[model samples]
Target: MPSPFTLAITGQSLIHHDIRACVDPGFLQIVEILKKADVAFTNFEGTILGRHGGSPMKGSYFGYSDPQVLDALKQAGFNALALANNHAFDLGPPGILSTLEEVRARGFLHAGIGLDRDHAIAPGVAAIRSRLIGLVAMDAGPGPRTMYADNARYRRPSRPGVNQLEVTRIFEADRAAFDMLATIQTTFQISKLERANYAQPDDPPVLDEDAEIDFYGTIFRRADVNRRVIAVDPDSASIHLEAIARARSREQFVIAYLHHHHWEPNWRDVPDWVRAFAHACIDAGANVFVSHGTPVLQPIEIYKRAPIFFGLGNFIFHTEKGETEWSSPDVWKSVVATCAFDPAGPLQIDLLPVALGGEERIEGLDFHERQVPMVASGKIAQQIIDDLAERSAIFGTTIERHGPTGRIQVSEGQR
Candidate 1:
């Protein structure tokens, strides 16, 4: 065994502008912590769509910025990056190719996007501190067909895209909702017959056997209801588990990471499938697990002696543009996670609360502009620590104040 090793983890990073010029001093201190770790990791949220190549999606936008952002990340101590976020396929194949080229050229180990599903699902291996580390990044969603990597056929190759974990949404309507849908089906039948009599070539499928949806046509609206469950596609989970099992035999540690925008009824708790997936990976021999994309800190669970971060929020969230960038408060805060693991297992985990800063955010529009992540102070910092402790309590994890950060307490036996 290579003694004990520490892994520093963080959430999404978007370095659209120059980090050195736009960021402040406190951000550098956080970087110093990351540098001290055996391996430092973060999810790269934006894509390098190049200067003049890609087109945006139909209604929504995909993240794209200068390719030089890779250099900025290297300076921040990110030796490895998760590339399986919603933005992976933003610029199509060219973007995917460009990203892989730049990231690899910069000497960063990244996994997620690939030319086909096999490579996409495969783990990116790194030899850190004489111990082999394997990483597999995936996302359940924030959807569009373009974002997922496709499995290849006998001859034709699969498309270039991000690794995907398919989530099957199962609708379990109650008596009222079920009856209403049935009524809609009956009414739609009459309309279909009328359309057929009126010389329409084909009417829409009233009852979709696969979808369990009763709708008239393509243009329809479905209200938010509780009679449904987000189920993880077992095939996808098993595929990843198989990879982890293989890596475990050959490597010293395996880190499985997921990037999804999915959340539970309250944005605080993790969705059931997320928990299930984390446990499955640990069972398959993953030493550490990570999740991001909620953009807010959502508790932590120590599963089978391994740490599972459901959502780490933003390590560096300098949102200059977004639909609600001007109003959303959740984007301004997050934490930096530090984990110390020895050959036996994990020893200690620390959560340091940090606040995102810049001109756009802060004491209103009057604050000076700069993109940086400052160690939160006073009331703002305590509030984050308190909320995190409350959320993590369900998993039997405790948070005690240690200077400006919170030390996540785990049983000594659990280590």
Candidate 2:
């Protein structure tokens, strides 16, 4: 058996500034925790605009960071990065290539975006302590279809983009409600207009099921209740699972990562589909599963002795000034989780709660200074741990709060 290993994981890092010179005590404290781990992992949530120049493919909230931001992340001790997120393609294919170039130049173990579909779906491997660690990263996007990697076909060349796990939002309505929508569709000739203006020959034939209707681009299915359902593309799921299995077959510790914005109505709630998918990845051979996209912490589950973090929220969130969308206090509270894997013993995880800029706004601090994470202390620390414990309890994963930190120990036979 290989020697015991330690992995430190953080949430999304939407960084836009260079903070290598910051001397804030809180920030330094968080950095110290990360530096102690053998492999520090975090989702690199934005594209890097470097020599491979590209135009913005998005409108408001376009996220593209300078190359120096990687220097700051390296300074903060993040050696493993998941480079698949909604903003990964903010500058289109060129942006994907550029980000890959910069991240590779930094010598970080990175995965997710790649030169083509096959490349993007492959796992990234790194050797640590004479043991191989593999990461398979993907983005479950509710974003544009054009942002995902595609292979060459016919006369078209392959595209460089983020590895995407396609997801579909489905709305289910009862018979009465379904009929009402159908009546409106007929009255307004909605389907006719859609066919005339946007329908393509290759568009999947509308569901022939009597009770299902394709309204505009949304799928509405008939059911006994009114609710929304999130569906993952099975093919995409299989592709990622195969990558994990291949890594596992090579005797590597596999870490499966996902980034998505298909959040539940309540941001704090974990989506059921995401839970199922995480379980599937674990069953396929992943030792650790982590996801992000929602800007607030969700819950953690210990499934079959493998740790699954549904959402860890933001670690380095640098939003634009006056951005009220992510102004919630919960968005700034998260934990830096360190997991220890011992071949002869149980897996132990320590969660160190952190707050952005000490949980209070400083009068003179700018975005970069105020948004850096600091190790949480006092009531705020307890509150963060307590909330996480409450949510994680739903998964039957008990987190023992030890003052400002939380811990979980899963024996080899726990599952």
Candidate 3:
């Protein structure tokens, strides 16, 4: 193991148009740089699962890379991947299962999602020498309702097709039986809860009793056949707890990779749930919280001695043709704005080269391209680093920006 370990991270990137050329040789170069360090981590933004039947959700933009992408990461020496992101389930459970199978077969560790909410909270941890490393992945925003592993209908062979649920769902026939059963289960659970708590029998548990009776009545009264009691909402809290539990089991650094951000610059306000989740994760013993999903990077702060990296901007898309527009300094201002400099002085932070792999060209042809014209040329990457350093000053982020290399040197803050 390298004496001083280094790791790198980036944002959501896609290679939909030309999968092969998308990951250039520069990717290998980046990996070579990272190889000098102990381990490297990154978010696998696209799914590599082999399944094809899961109903693509409405209004969903899906991205997928060949399974060989995993081989590329191995060649690049990337040991871990955060799979808890929006696209992981684009093909539904089959996609997710295939992804898990592939990752396992490749001997790579992944976490932040699973067959159910419980799996989402458990993290992938690898013991590196005297230190332990953990990775978590989570997503925010709307998407398919994640079903648990044991849910009856979603079992191995036969499962209802999944699609991105529209804001307004019209009645569909296939959903009827499941909806009825779900109503029954829900009613029973509520009745059980009422019986358990039955506080001040006079009130008789207002929410469930009448609701249960009404639910049963409604099921019988309804003509619609398509009401299923599917677990629609993503239940991630338990997963979060389980992940922390795994981290604690190991005597090493605990890092959680979350795909959802607690705040966004464009959004004037931060959601309370977001803030609570971050704080809650920290309280549960996560040493570092790395979050993604926001197009641009966000702030990085240490709450209760636990650092939260709100976002890591897109790194692999530099070479892709159309995305070149994102190379501007202004677009990366948030990354510049939140970088925290080590107090000691200008010294290189452990730089790890994590590469984008596979093959594809800007013109959508299969070919090996090493350098992304915009970033490989150094001009844009350097400017992005410089711009971030400049903006970060406003946030009191004291970082050391190399003259034009965009390479970061974090200080230890004080002598």
- lDDT of candidate 3 over 1-415, digit per residue (tens): 2134444444444323333343545454554554554555667766664654354533525556667777766565556777766677666666766777777888776775565544545567777644577766566533434422223444444332221211211123344554565566676775545543543212222233322323322222233444323222334465565567667666545667656433433532333455456677787777566766655545444465445555655544423333444433333222211122222333343212122222222223222232221223234444445544564455344445444344443344421
Model 3 lowest lDDT segment of ten: 161-170
Q: Can you write out model 2's per-residue Cα lDDT over 159-245, one digit (the tens) per residue?
A: 899899988888999999899989988898775557535534225335746878877666789999999999898987888998999
Each candidate structure's TM-score, on Cα atoms with residue i matched to residue i, is: 0.87, 0.95, 0.61
Off by over 4 Å in 2: 192-206, 362-369
lDDT scores in order: 0.76, 0.88, 0.48
lDDT of 1 by residue, 308-415 (tens): 999987776545443443344555678888998865544688887787783235445322243667777667778888888888889777778776679865555773
Report how far off residue 30 is in candidate 3 (Å).
Answer: 1.7
Which stretch of 10 consecutive residues in model 2 shows the poorest summed lDDT?
196-205
The global Cα lDDT (0 to 1) of model 3 is 0.48
Query: Which structure among the candidates has the greatest lDDT?
Result: 2
Candidate 1 residue spans exceeding 4 A from truth: 154-156, 189-211, 214-226, 358-370
Give the Cα RMSD of candidate 2: 2.2
TM-score of 2: 0.95
